[model samples]
Target: MNHFLALTRRGAIALAFALTLPLPAVAATKIQHLISPGGIEAWFVQDSTVPLIAMEYAFGGGATQDPPDKPGVGNMVASTIDEGSGDLDSKAFHERLDRRAIELSFSITRDYFRGSLRMLKDNKDEAFDLLHMALTSSHLASSDVERIRSQIMSGLRRDTTNPNALASRKFLELEFANHAYSRPASGTLESVPTITVADMRDYISRVIAKDTLKIAVVGDVDPATLGQLLDKTFGSLPAKAKLTPTPDVVATAPPQRAFVPLDVPQTTITFGAPGVMRHDPKFMAAYIDNHILGGGGLSSRLYHEVREKRGLAYSMFEALLWMDHSSLVVGNTGTRADRAGESIDAIDKEVRKFAQEGPTQQELDEAKSYLKGSQMLQLDTSSKLATAMLQYQLDKLPIDYLERRSGIIDAVTLDDARQMAKRLWGQGLVTVVVGREPQAAAEAARAPGAPPPPKAN
Candidate 1:
């Protein structure tokens, strides 16, 4: 039997067992705060149900740390870091991983450079050693860098015609104008080519350090053993990161509609307005309010109005997006090119009404109940739990946040939810629609005395 398959089977069995536990038992998961001898720290959840370990970690200064002209450096580093490290060439490094059934990967969001590792507990020593090498001694060789660059460039080319990508990119460009947040994390076609091996190495040195690190581990490991592994894996990094100070910014775009013309049959729409930050006292209220509005899936008001009532689109959604430095209530949907304007109108009307009237007492109660119960879905697996714990750490939430989460949601009264709705959505949305010009605009242009249609960008 394949070791990898065996491990996966055992993991599934463990997950099934975990799912059978009461929600309170899962929520009361004991989180041990551990500090290694070398001063490295991690949040650990000891689960001996399966002989596997999953680690998730992040460092501050993600794509925002890239040079303005070479915006993809952080992304490139993330893609190439695990290709080779220490004395191992690319092939040798991967072969070692394959032999041990270890899984290691890296990614970059606008605010964080993240990594994850999963392996059998029996191979913990080698797994941690490989992780340390990838962090401290990644060999971003010329050949590997060029190959990855080509891949990124190809993807960028494809994104040009992808309506969803176009709408999202244009929305960010318009909303965050002149701010670092506007730049694409994957680097643009022009920027990716300009990135060099030196840039990748420099980014790793400046951004990956103990000072900005947050880690979460879930597995069959004790605090003492985890403490030692933490030091051994991360202690060699620099004490502090040399991240450039990124300024706080809100959505600067005017509350108006922008259009990107593509030949796609279905128009993709992206819209947003300023929102509350993560640590704000009102965030929990905003969370419940958004759930009632659009974040609650099929039960949401947006879905019912846009899809069920109007039949304008198959689905629609909105959520509160809180970045490290900025926040927004963002939403998206798709519709036939000819019906795009109507769909937008329907969505906007609902949003404006919600902002004015807020949720009813019944809506508020149901939203609170659904949000409270959904916490279990986030903790059903070790990897998922690790990822969620890491995010809580990033958000500066307390370790007991899981236990306290339900109470927080329950405390948001109808009055509080109503207030939060007005605060979050009252400002209106700046919308981006990517497809052919809406039929309404086209008809207006063709009317007897109408001005000529505006040329596409």
Candidate 2:
């Protein structure tokens, strides 16, 4: 055990050093497309500078694949998939990973179930074998399932009182309404307890298949050897995923707002509007425009207006969200209960003005420069580079996208930014506030009869 701890320490030190070293330009990184003898495919970036390997992979069916009644089946599977597999129990399985300093984790978003692995080159064989077992033969024992389910329920219970979580949940529920996208990625307290081991196994059988797989690997591995590893690790998965066809959705354009009342000291606000899809011609333009509006940290217009000028909130931000089935421009901020209405009004005015007039020439130039320069940060480490590569694959971008990305950003002219801004954010926002009722709404409620204020959850 001491030797294992020492090796883990050494591995952490090596990773820290690797993170400090300068990374090659993404365009020059030379992503190699590889196909295994068994026809499994992966994107590989060979780097011998560090004696470590990082792998990131995703499958198409994410939380959306969960049965309508079982909203968190996919999330539960992600939690328990690595607990044990094959002949190993949870303790024995984790012991093997700890001995080798292998890092394995799984996560799921609305559209994809994702997993990552990091291990020293010398331990690659054991690492891949364990990963293979986890994916192909996860042992979702009843005890393990209940343990993870308890953990999930604990989180869900906490979220019930969490102002931010409540606001986000309310916003999605109001926006998506009847759509599965409205379901929380983490299963709710009620739904999580009812999920059985059989349900988890069924989720894996339907979702973890070769046809939906996207893999990206980085570090000291050659194409031929990586191909062999790919086949050995993933080739056994079902040839095709039995995914339910999810229809594309556009965010509700009719302005909608809802409030979930909690006794917190501050109100957390989440707002959203329709946004351009990833493949839209104006996406790049809208991306830059969003940065100027709220995506840029303290330099953003929203931050300047809300925090710097009026002191309504400590921080504010807006971002473009492109999901597999829908797209949205979402923003969030928190402020004192009494000032929540002021914060909302400030944000609305800024958004409307920006949509009509767009970013200034200086703002546009600065945004473009920052976007280009910050690209390197995303690839500075092996794990980060692998994750970025996986996203590129998921987006269906060309192999040479990094090389042409700057050119694409540069092509967005002032006119494009203005047009995209109006098109993306001009529709107005669907807002959700959680905490004390806003001052204006409270006053109106006290007056005549303002529909008796929406019931608090």
lDDT per residue for candidate 1 within 1-457, as digits (tens), equals: 0000112111233334543443333335888788888888888888877677888999999889999888899999988998899999889988888777777788888889988888878889898999999999888999999988998899999999998899889988887887888999899998999898888888998999999999999887888888889999998899999999999998764477898988766789998888788999978999888888988888999999998888888558887877888877778898766678888999899999999999999999998888888888758778778888888898999998888899998888888988988887887889999988666545654679855543211
| lDDT tens per residue, model 2, 1-457 | 0000001212244444554465564326888898889998888889887787889899998999998888999989988898899999988998888777788888888889888888888989899999999998888998998888888898899999998889888888877887988998788877888888888888899999999999999888888888899999998899999999888877788477888888766789999787777888888998999899999998999999988888889558888888887888889998866678888899999989998999989999999999998987768878778888888898889987888899999999999999988887777789998877566445655767534543222
Runs in model 2 deviating more than 4 A are 1-27, 439-457
TM-scores of the candidates are 0.91, 0.92
Worst 10 residues of 1 by lDDT: 1-10
How well does candidate 2 score on lDDT at residue 116? 84
- Mark the regions of model 1 whose C-alpha exceeds 4 Å error after superposition: 1-27, 439-457
TM-score: which candidate is best?
2
Q: In candidate 2, what residue range of length 10 has the lowest lDDT sum?
A: 1-10
